[model samples]
Every structure is written in C-alpha cells, then in structure tokens.
Target: MNAVVHFLILLVVLSAAAFILFLLRAPFWLILLVIVAVYMAVTTVPTFHTVYKSQNLRAIDRFLLRNYRKPIFNYAYNIGHGTDEEIRNSLRTIIDKSSRGDARHVYSALLGVHSGDGDEVLAHAGKINPGPLRSYYYAYGTALNGDLDEAGRIAGKITDEWMKHTIYAVIAKKQGNPEEFRKEAKYAEDASVGIQHYLLHHNFRKMAESFNLSQEGSSMMQLVENTAVELKDGRRGLILGVRDNEEIVQYDVELGDGEIITVFAEEVRRPV
Candidate 1:
C-alpha cells in the first residue's frame, strides 16, 4: 500500500515538473537532470535517512556493502566458548552500541543459557524488548535458576514453534526425562532453519551428551569436532566445523588434498 502511494506521489511530482519545464521551454538535458535528481531524492535519500536514524548495525553494514553478513552472533558464541579477552571486549562493544530492540542481546543470552548461567541470561534478557525472544531467554533463565514449572508455563505461551519446543526440550532435560528431551528436541529441530537451527542443534547435541543418549532420530547428526567422515564424491575428509545455514546443512570438511570445502550434509557420511 505504501509503495503504491509512493509511486503515485512520484508520478504526480514528475508530471508537474515536466509540465512546468515544457512551459518554460527548458533544455532537454536540463529537464532530464532535474527528473533524475528528484527520483534520487524521493528514493535513495529517504532510505539513507531511515537507515541512519535506526542505528542498526546490520542495516548500516548492509547499506555500505550489500553482501555483508554480520559476525556479531559468532562473537557472542565465542563468548560462551571461553574466547580471549579481546574477542569478549569486541562483542561487548558491539552489544553496547547496537539498537536496544536489536536481536544481538538474544544471541548473547542464548550463549548464557548454553553455559547454564541464569544470572547472565537474566541480565541479557532485561536488555531485550518485551517480546517472544525476550520471553524465551527469561524462561531459560528461570529454568536454570531451578523453576522448571514456571519456565514451562512461560514457554507454553510462546507461539514460535522453534522457541517453544526448544525450551520444552531444555525443561525436559532439567526434569531428567531423557525420552521427553529427545522427543521435544526432534520437534524443535524440524521447525528450525538457518543459523537458529545450527545453534539449536549444537546446544541440543551438548545437552544430549550430558544425558548419555545417542542421537538416534534427528536429521542433524551429532558430529564431534576433529572427526573423520566420507564425502559423497568418494573421497575422505575431516570435520573442521559445522557452519552453514538454510534448508540444507553443511560442514567445513578438509579433503585429502588439504582443501577445505563446505559440503552439504547429504554429500558427507560417517566412515563405514
């Protein structure tokens, strides 16, 4: 609807300018320049202004470079993995400067939840807006603080399938029900895609290991670090990292020729 309105307005403005120029007998080149300038003013300038006022790091980064993907989430993940001080400081700086409604805090809170730090998760939760993402972290923090019932209650109201089932899985794990955890985790994994799926799978794998349960039914196999696997092209490789997103899962695998390639999950398999 807004696009239609904008297009109508542009059309009217251009028509008026053209009429006035025709009446004034303006040069063809001069009229064309004015129209081009008006078009930029009506389109590009407002886009730049909106991005500038929002102060969204991702938006600003994309404005400068169309293909840039923010590494802020990776930095937060590193924080939970016991990264160096410099990396932690960099993440802190990014979080501090990011817009209040930005989702970076949630990523950090997820890491806190992964580490079982209720305090850290709560702190990050407070920084987020009142929404499903904030509620998700709040429930995780509550669970970590030993209130499984309340956490489950909070999670039950969440509408996002991924968030709801993932939290249920966490609550089930806390309740020492390995079967429930496995069931809920399968649902969660099925509903998730992209980076959310990757992160959730990683956390779920770690939680599953804690229960001494083999991942039997999940599509995302629990591939450990530094493991050997076979590529689909009849070659061998070592798992370097699991770091792809979207409908297809991918892994960073180093081939026998010492070349690292990000191959799809179906293109790799466990050694026979």
Candidate 2:
C-alpha cells in the first residue's frame, strides 16, 4: 500500500513538473532533473523520520537506565531480554544485594514462585506489611506449598480487584482448573492498566502457559493480523501483530495517531 501511494505521488509530482516545464518551454534534461530531485526528497523524508524516531527511542532507554538506576528497572530489563539462567541470576543478585523493601520481597516471591520454593516465598511474605499485597504473597506461597484450597481462601480476602483476581487465577491454575483459571485470569487482565499490566503479562506468562490457554489463530480472541479494532478506551487502532503467549495474548496496536501501544486481548474489542 505504501509503495503504491509513493508511486502515485511520484507520478503526480513528475507529471505536474513536466507540464509546467512544457508550458515554459524548458529543455527535457532540466525537467528530468527536477523530477528526480522531487522523487528523492519525497521518499527520503519518510526514511529520515523513521531513523530519527528509532534513534530517539533508543536514547530515551539509555537515559532511563542511566538516571533511574533502580534495581527493579534492571530486573524488568533482564526479564524482557535475558535467558532463563540470566533472569535467575539477576533475581538472586537483587535479593542478595538490594536493601530490604517491597521490591525485594516481590523479587524474592517471583523467584520463589518460579522455583516452587515455598520457604523462599514465605520468608518474604512474612516481611511484607500486612495488607492485600502481603496476603497475596502469602496465598501464593501457600499455594506453592500444596494448599490450593487454603490459598484460595486467603486470596479471597484481598480487597484490591486486580490483585484479588490475579491471586485467584494463580490458585485456580495450581488447582488444575483450566476453565476457572481462564475466567479469573481474564478478570485480572481486564482490571490491569499500563505498566502494571505489562509487568504482570511478562512475569506471569510462563506460569500462564502451563494452562495451554489459546493459540494465536484462535477465533475466540477475535483478533486478526493487521485488522482494525477499538480499544477499551474507545480509541481505534490497527493490530500490527500479536504476542501469543498461550494463556496471555497481547496486541501491538498502531493507533490512528501513529503511536504504537501494547494491550492485552481484553483491552480491545471489535470496532463499533
């Protein structure tokens, strides 16, 4: 489509320039030179803009890494880009060296959940101040320790909707109820927004895959490659691609304004 547009644009420009030159009785060589110049300018401008945008994004990433300097930032980067062994090493180093805080507890709990080490999970769960968050960690730890019923009971007490639904989904997964897991997981996914959603999808995706949820081509998702869809917020976008992580499906949507954002399947709907 872009190629066709560019071709039509070039043809129109060249035709216009040739007509003007003919009216002025200019030489053929001069008309050809002007057409070549116009074509080069039109095509190269988009290339330049694309290259500048790519470089700008990279620069922003470098600036964040330099100034943010948080252990969690590094952990997020490693989770996205590193191998399983690298992620384990990064988590362990963060646990060993980072000062005790909620981030540390979260790091510990995720590693524990991945490793199925109830003791590791409980160790951090106890340090977290009593609240919905702490209850979630405890419930997850209990679930890891082979008490799905008790875990479900504990998770049920969490008041925060997203956290509550997420814990329940995990418990359902542990209990081997795929239907319950999918239902609760969708609730959690729907309640999440922005970066919190990103973190959940990335960190919990492997565990989600254990349920063998849905495929990229599943019509149940109602998503097709490059199709237009409406966001939950009523914005329209084109689906650039699908990130099909079994139980978790995210779409890279290019909005009408040309800003690309990642959103979970539940965050989008068929265009109205």
Q: Would you list the C-alpha lDDT of every candidate in the order shown?
A: 0.67, 0.67
Off by over 4 Å in 1: 1-70, 73-101, 217-272
User: Residue by residue across 1-272, what tens digits does model 1's lDDT show?
Assistant: 13456699999988888789989999999899889888888878856563434333223322322211245543433322323553455455566766765567875786576566898998989888889988888898988998999999999999999899988998999899999999999898778754355446556776797898876432233464454565668776556678657676778865544466778788875641
Q: Which one is best on TM-score?
A: 2
Worst 10 residues of 2 by lDDT: 58-67
Off by over 4 Å in 2: 1-70, 215-272
lDDT of 1: 0.67
The residue pairs found clashing in candidate 2 are none
Clashes of 1: 0
| Candidate 2 lDDT tens digits, 112-215 | 87677887888988888788778888988898898888888997888877788887888887788888877787777567654344345444555556776662
